[model samples]
Target: MTVDLIAVVPRNSRGRGVQRYYDAQSECAFFVSEPSGQPELWHRYLDGARDVYRRFGVEQALEYDAVADGASTSLFFAALNADGDMVAGTRIQGPYTDARQAHALVEWAGRAGADDLRRMIADRIPYGVIEAKGAWVARDAAHRAELGAAISRTVLHGARLLGARYGLATVASFTVPRHEACGAMPAERIPAVPYPDERYRTVPLWWDTRGYSAFAEESQRFSTQAEQDALGLTAVRPLDARCGAGRAAESRRGHGR
Candidate 1:
């Protein structure tokens, strides 16, 4: 997860404002944003993640329905190459006012006797709670980097930037261990909700950032270097104020919540 902060820019070639990070360990580039101010880029990134989800046969995993209102309080995290092509990406949503955005979990809560999850979030993580969603990595790009760990770090880092204290994710049974290693707990009472036409089941997990020691020990992952040629070299460019304005047409078109 170690990367160097080589440059900080307001926008990339696609005109989307982002915080870029580079990792020399795998010679990979990382990009992240919290509800990107650039609407078009946000949509495009979401689309890319969605495309990958469909490939995995779980299009419903994409939370497009909730964010359709367009007031996306979501963060998009991506991994790319030096060329800047999106090799992998995912979305993180929330700090929700309530559990409404967690559609599936909320629907299944009562039946699973996990209605307390809402109370737990309210009591322990009332603010800055982020939901990890639509995680995907390109098959071809897997060899170059640890997409799961990389993106999980991206989500955690993005959450920290957004002032969130906790993270939640509902993922397939098989994907649970990877997240646990990054510091998350399997949320109790989250029933096996069938998705992608009942062939799949998803479970929910929650993580208290304070409880996770990985991020602390892995601090090197976010470190930057002055030299660009170093091995495991990486870079992080924070989003600039200028990039927040977005495109004039997009602003004019407006968006809903």
Candidate 2:
């Protein structure tokens, strides 16, 4: 049920530029990079995410400007076709110090379930929490479902790599099943919010990195575990120096997660 086709290839001598993950079964290559480490690819990811958001009529919700410089992002994940065109991607933000740091707090502000959403994040912050955002897939990409599954696995891989105990994602109602397959559970106690407009009902989902296998689908369990194992051997680079300093300062201020 699991394919052992994912391999990580370092894209730079210093191990800081980009790390490529090639999935032979899908013939799709996934790249993980920091904005400062590989600006070009980082921009590609931003552009791709923007395009997807625009087409979905949720561009405003994306808050592109806020993440353009990638100061708030810990890592970027891009999935490219064999022809080298990016088809899907997502980004990781945090290991947050406070519940208010989650984008959901802002999105749910003055809306239904805002308080419960805040509580959910606050409870996880002490365990180390990261948010997976800007996730998208090209409309015309082949094997879209398979690619989506791969991207979900990246959430697990990323959370583990970043030392996060939990991961958060706010997704449209329809996408909940896909994420759930990869061990993301909806915060059902908090009513779903009509975000970016009433056209969609968005719900907050959480991934307990330490116990995901208990809920993840069989194939996902094997594949995510395989990918996480592979990532363990890869030398993922640290955040940009300025970003590192900022994190240090936040920690010193007693805001560390």
Name the best candidate (by lDDT): 2
Candidate 2 displacement at residue 134 in angstroms: 0.6
In the range 193-247, model 1's lDDT, one tens digit per residue, is 6654477777766665444433223432333221122322233332232334354
Looking at model 2, residue 143 earns an lDDT score of 83
Worst 10 residues of 1 by lDDT: 248-257
What CA root-mean-square deviation does each model show from the true structure? 12.5, 9.9
Q: How well does each candidate superpose onto the true structure, as a TM-score?
A: 0.70, 0.83
TM-score of 2: 0.83
Compare the candidates by TM-score and give the number of the best one: 2
